[model samples]
Target: MATEKRNYKRVMLKLSGESLANDKGFGIDPEVVYRLAGEIKEACETGIEVAVVVGGGNIWRGLKGSQGGMDRASADYMGMLATVINSVALQDALEKLGVSTRVQTAIEMRQIAEPYIRRKAIRHLEKGRVVIFGAGTGNPYFTTDTTAALRSAEIEADVMLMAKKQTDGVYDADPKFHPEAKMFTHLTYNDVLQKQLAVMDNTAITLCMNNSIPIVVFNIDVPGNIVKACKGETLGTLIEGE
Candidate 1:
C-alpha cells in the first residue's frame, strides 16, 4: 500500500516547558514525556524530518526571576540550563521509544551533548534523527519561542508547530478566562502582530514572517495531535504571510 503524502517534509515542534510537567504542575512528568515521544515516533515514521525546541518555564522562568530581584542576565542563563535539563529528559524518553534522537545545546556542555552545529543538525534530521535544541540561543532575554523560530529558519523546516497544553488554538483573548474569545483558524503574520496575539512573542513571529515560515498553534493534550499537525491536517490555527 502506498503511504499517504504529508503536507510538510520537515517540521519544527515548539513545546512549552509546562507540557512536560505532571498534572499541569511543575517538574518533568515521565508518563507525559513517554506519550509525547510515542507521538513523535509516529510522525517520524511518516518519513518527515522532525526537530523540537523546548521551553524552560516548568523549571525556571527568567522573567519571574528578574521580577523577584535577581540579575536579569543571570536569571536568564539559569533558565537556559533548565531547558537543557528538559531536553535531556526528552532525549531519554524518545530513545526508550526506539526513536533516534539528539540533544544539541547552544551553550556547549560537551560532556552531556553535542554543540549546536547547523550542518550537523540538518544531517541528523536527514538521517531520521530528531534534533532537540536547548539553551535558548545561548543568549539572555531571548525566549525559547524565538529559539524555535530561529532554528526552524536555519533548518529550513516547512512549518513551525506550536504545541500548547490545553488551549485549542490562537484566540482573540485568553480562552480560559474569556468565554467569548474567538479562535482564529487562519491568520497572516500581520494579523498576529497587529492583533498582538499571544501565540508567540513578536520577535519569534517576526522572524518567521521574515523567513517565510508558517506556524501552527494547537492543543497538544489531545493524543495524535502532533502527528496530525505534521501531516498538515489543520488541527489548529495556521499563521502565515501573504
Candidate 2:
C-alpha cells in the first residue's frame, strides 16, 4: 500500500491505560501492546517524531483509591508507578518491532528508565527515537492527558493525537449511550471548552490551546489510524484555534 504524504514533523500521542488491557479491561495485554506498537512503528517510519503519554487507569485510578480512603497523594503516587509499568511494556513491544524507543518518567527510576529531562527527550526525538513519557508530570491530581499536553509543548510537537480505544472521534455525547450523538469533524479549542466536550481534560485542552498545538482525536484500535493521523488524512476529529 502506498503511504500518504506526512503532515506533521513531530506529534504527541496520548493513550489510555485501558488501551493496553484485554477484553476484561485489567492488566497488560501483550497482544494489544504488540498491535499498538506495530501501528506506532508505522507512524515512526513516516518520518514523524512521536512521543507518547499513557494513562494508568487500567492498573489503578488514583481518584478511586483516594475515594476508598487512601491518602490522595499516596494513591496518586501509586498511579504514577502504574504508568511506568505500562510505559515499559510499550517500550518492550516497540523495541521487539525494531523501533528505537525510550521510556522517560517524571518520577526518577534510573534502574528502569531515564528521568524526564526536556532537552534529552527532545534530543531523542530528533534522533528518530520514539519517546514514551510516564508518571504523569510526577505530581498528584493531574491526569495523563495534562502530561500529554505539557510534553507536547515542551517537545514542540506540531500536533497532539488523542488515541481512543474504540471511539473514532470526539462526539457531542457518549456515542455508546447516544447513538445519535453528533461527531464534529473539526472543532475549535473554545468549542471543546464552551461545550464541555469530553475529548480531554480542561487542563490538557488549555495547554494545547495556549501552545497553539492542533489535536487529532481518533480510534487507535483501528489499524493504520495512527499513521493516517500523522499524514493528515482526516480520519478523525481535528481541534485547533479558530
Candidate 3:
C-alpha cells in the first residue's frame, strides 16, 4: 500500500550528524545512512520536494572545544567540513539506492559539490532530485540548525523537519538523563526561545521565528518517521506561531 501523499511542495529536512552514526558518535553508519536515504526516496516519489541540512556534532562541536585554543573561525570551518562529510555520506547512500541527489556546499569545494545556488537548488527539487545542503551557512559561530532555517527561507520551503537520534519530541528537560522530563506536543516559537530548549540554537530560533517556518522535532531512529513528518502526521512537537 502506498502512503498518502504530503501537501508539501517543498520541505527542508534537518539531520544531525549523530543520525549518520550510532552511540559511537563518530563516522557515518552505512545502514543508518541507507535507511535515511530510503525514506527520502519514498518522500520524493510521493511528489514532494526535499532539501536536507545535516549537522556536524558527530565530527566536532565548536562550543565543546572552544577552550582547546582553537580559533573560532577554524573550529567553525571544521564543523562545516563535518557537515560536508555527513552530506557526502548521505549523497552516496541515496545514489546507491537509486535516488538522484546533489550535494551543495555553502563554502565552495568545486571538486566535491556545487556551491550553494538558490535557483539551481530549486530547479533540482522541481525536477525531483534530493538536495543535501552542507557547510553550515558558510560562516562561523552558526549552528547547522540555523543553516537549515536560512536555507529553508532561501528555498521557500513549507516546513523544517528536525530529526533527532532519541527522544521523539521536544521535552522540558534532558529525557535521556532525566526520565521525569515532560514533553510538549505543541509549542510556540517564543516558548522554545524563552525556555531555552536545546532542540535548536537561539540564532536558529530567531531565524525561524522571524520567517514563520514551522519546525517538527521527532526521533529519526524510528523507521518511517521522516515520511511521517513529511506526510504531516501529528507525531512530533510542532513549533510555530503561538
Best by TM-score: 1
**Backbone clashes (count) for model 2:** 0
| Deviating ranges (above 4 Å) for candidate 3 | 1-6
Per-structure clash totals for the candidates: 0, 0, 0
What would you estimate as the lDDT of candidate 1? 0.93
Per-residue CA lDDT of model 2 for 75-176, tens digit only, reads 999999999999999999999999999999999999999999999999999999999999999999999999999999999999999999879899999989
Q: What overall lDDT goes with each candidate model? A: 0.93, 0.91, 0.89
Taking all chains together, the TM-score of candidate 2 against the true structure is 0.96
Candidates sorted on lDDT, descending: 1, 2, 3
lDDT of 3: 0.89
Weakest lDDT window of 10 consecutive positions for candidate 2: 1-10
Sort order, TM-score high to low: 1, 2, 3
- What is the TM-score of each predicted model, taking all chains together? 0.97, 0.96, 0.95
Clashing pairs in 1: none
Q: How does candidate 3 fare on TM-score?
A: 0.95
Candidate 1 at 181: error in angstroms? 1.4
